[model samples]
Target: MAGAAATGGSARSDTYASARNWLLLPSWAVLCIFVLAPVAMMLVYSFLTKEFRGGVIWEFTLAAYDQFFFDRGLFGDEPARIDWTYILIFWRSIWQAGLATFLALLIGFPTAYFIATRPAQTRTVWVFLITIPYWVNLLIRTVSMKFLLRDQGPLNDFLLATGLIDDPVRIINTNAAVQIGLFYSYLPFMVLPIYASVERYNFALSEAAADLYASKWTTLRRIVIPSVRPGIIAGCILVFVPSLGAFLAPDLLGGAKNFMIGSLIEEQFKGNAGNWPFGAAASMILLTLVLVILMFLARQQARADREATS
Candidate 1:
């Protein structure tokens, strides 16, 4: 009778496992087809050349790559074109992303710290407030900033009325405006991970550090920071990668002159002179850059976790 009971239990376990596997198979298949297949297509497209009159040519060619790497036009002659628009866009995107990430971290750390330290019931309210705006559409939120930042907007009017300035500040149509947009847009992403990390943090670590005569600054540096490194990394990636490829915010809030990789890609896909091949190559480059950064982030997180365990 005992042997028969054990055999029945094993049969149930096998059935459950098989059922779970069946459930996951379709989702995995969808992911492979939609995500991996598109990525594979981009990789292939990156190697092809843009045809003079239209779409990508099937013939193998290195001209697009060569132009991307080595050639540069003279100043005033074709606007001193850099053949490697991909690299230039990459750098600019990263630069903007870096700034956005840094700002988000600075602002989010304090807010998350406060929220996480709150009582359980109060913490729920604070978290809701922080995330509520995120429910709004990204496009609507970005366009709303224009109304607030324009030369004749309320902000400028207030400054003028208060005698803060004789003229309106150039808050709109500049990199600064775009930066503001990026910060506002990505701030929630920065906060969520940090709040999660901070809430899980053991205050005893800092208390022990203090008992060792560590100054407040030193305690934060050595204890608080190291403990929350994972959250910081997650927040940075959340803010940076999105800001890097951000399109709507920059487009709606800043000047046409301030172009980013996302805008450039949009131009290729939908603007006056659509070049699908060039856009595909640019998309592939951006995707590769993201994958590389994520790899580094994963390694860093693993190392931190290992150190924490040790």
Candidate 2:
């Protein structure tokens, strides 16, 4: 009887362990299938050849990567030349992304700080308002900006009625328009992260700094900013990387004048310039640049975290 009871208990324990393990299997399988598999495919495709036709060739080739770094000679010579266009597009994307990130930070940081310091009930309302636009599709929101910014759009019409200008200024298809689009698209990304960080901010530190005769600016710089640095960093990453690959906003708002790297890649893939290899190489290059930036940000974040913990 004693032996039978012990055996029954061991069986139950084994069954429970098996059930628990089985329950976790689906989640792990889904992650491997959806995320890890696609990344692996992209890595493999980056090295393959794009045939003259629409499909990719299985034959391994370094030519695509070679073109990414060094441009082929105009006559297709032995020594590959440098492609300045790639570099130019890269720099332009970075510049635009950097500007958008900076503006978003300037605006979002204070707004988030305000929301975080508010009472709990008010904070909920503020957060809801901040994120309301996100419920809409990104493309829809971007297109809606056009109706307001076009030559005879409401904004221009209002300005003309007020005698703000002699004629409607060409605001829609310029770098200024691009900046506006970028700021609009990336504002939420900036705000959310900053809000998360600022909510975790130590209220007592600010009070202590104030008691030490620190000015408002000094208190913010010394106490508040440092405490919420993670949020600011997170906001920058959220805004900057995506802004670099921004396509529709620049295409519709800024027109063809300010074509970013993303636009170029799209052209290569879909437009008359049907060079899939080139497009893939360009994409890989863009991914590499983003990874480098992400690494730097990660290192910085780690250092900041260490300092904070220490």
Q: Rate the local accuracy (lDDT) of all candidates.
A: 0.86, 0.86
What's the C-alpha lDDT at position 83 in model 2?
78
Q: Which stretch of 10 consecutive residues in model 2 shows the poorest summed lDDT?
A: 271-280
Regions more than 4 Å wrong, model 2: 1-24
TM-score of 1: 0.86
Give stretches of model 1 more than 4 Å off: 1-21, 49-57, 72-86
lDDT of 2 by residue, 1-310 (tens): 9999999999999999999999999998999999778666766766778876544788788777777678777766757677777788779889999999999999999999989989999999999999998898888988999888999999999999999897998889898888899999989899999999889878889889999999999999988888888888999999999999998788888898898888877876784546676677778788888999999999989887887778
Q: At residue 209, what lDDT does model 2 achieve?
A: 91
lDDT of 1 by residue, 1-310 (tens): 9999999999999999999999999999999999989888877776787765557788676545545555545442443345555677678778988999999999999999999999999999999999898899999999999899999999899999999999999899998999999999999999999999999999999899999999989998999989998998999889989998999877888778678888988877674476667777778768888989999998999888887678
Clashes of each: 0, 1
